[model samples]
Every structure is written in C-alpha cells, then in structure tokens.
Target: MCVVGIMVGLLLLFAAPGVGSLSLGFLFLLGAWFCLWFFPHDLAHHVVGRVLGVGFRYYFLGRSAITN
Candidate 1:
C-alpha cells in the first residue's frame, strides 16, 4: 500500500509539469521515505512493546528503543 502510494505520486510528478508538481512530488517522496524508513520502528516500539509486556522508556533517533 505504501509503495503503491509512492509509485502513484512519482507517476503524477513526472507526468505533470510545473513547480507545484515538483514540490508535491518532492514532499511526497520525502514523506514516503520517512514512512518506509522510520514509521515501522516507531510503530513496533509502541505495539510490540505493549504486546510483549515490555515497557519502553524512550526512543533514540528511531534506531533504538530504551526499555524498562
């Protein structure tokens, strides 16, 4: 789903023309990158943590999670 959204955005970005389209594509790409790269870790920290009964004290740059 996420990949699909990014692909569609890229297609529109290239198919359309103008500064506005470029900016939209750039922002979409940036957001997609973040979602694919960062969102999963953060999501796991919250979901898996609680599910496994592990308590997270905090997160470090999304690369790691500190637990209690």
Candidate 2:
C-alpha cells in the first residue's frame, strides 16, 4: 500500500501538464483496485495462517471472508 501510494505520487509528480490531475486520480484508483485484487479477504487470512504455522478455514458471505 505504501509502495502503491509512493508510485502514484511519483507518477503525478512527473505527469505532463494539463493531465496530471487526471493521471493522479487514475493511478490512485488503479492502485486501490490492484490492492483489493491481491489481498482478497480469504487469501489474506490463509497467508497469515501460513506465516504463523497454523491452520485456518475461511468462511465467506457472497465474496467477503468472515474471519474468526
């Protein structure tokens, strides 16, 4: 997330005149989308469980995970 923020900041800083605002907004939106894509709730818990060497089961409602 920090990296994405920094990248978007840099992109806005270097964007061409008259288009920087649009570019910045687009970059921010893209960053958010990618973040959600990479960190889907169930996968997040699964990853955390693996890091802690514990077993986990993810329950989802529609598309969101319910973590216990």
How good is model 1 by TM-score?
0.38
Instruction: Give TM per candidate.
Output: 0.38, 0.34
Give the lowest summed-lDDT range of ten residues in model 2. 9-18
Question: Any idea how many clashes model 1 has?
Answer: 0
RMSD, one per candidate, in order: 7.6, 7.2
Question: What residue pairs clash in candidate 1, if any at all?
Answer: none
Q: What is candidate 2's lDDT per residue for 1-68, written digit by digit as tens?
A: 44565555455444533354776667766665555555454566667889999865654447536587
Clashes of each: 0, 0
lDDT of 1 by residue, 7-60 (tens): 665654454454356677677666656555644555655877799999778655
Instruction: Tell me the lDDT of model 2 at 14.
Output: 49
Model 2 CA deviation exceeding 4 Å by range: 1-20, 41-68
* CA error at residue 17 for candidate 2, angstroms: 19
lDDT of 2 at 53: 96
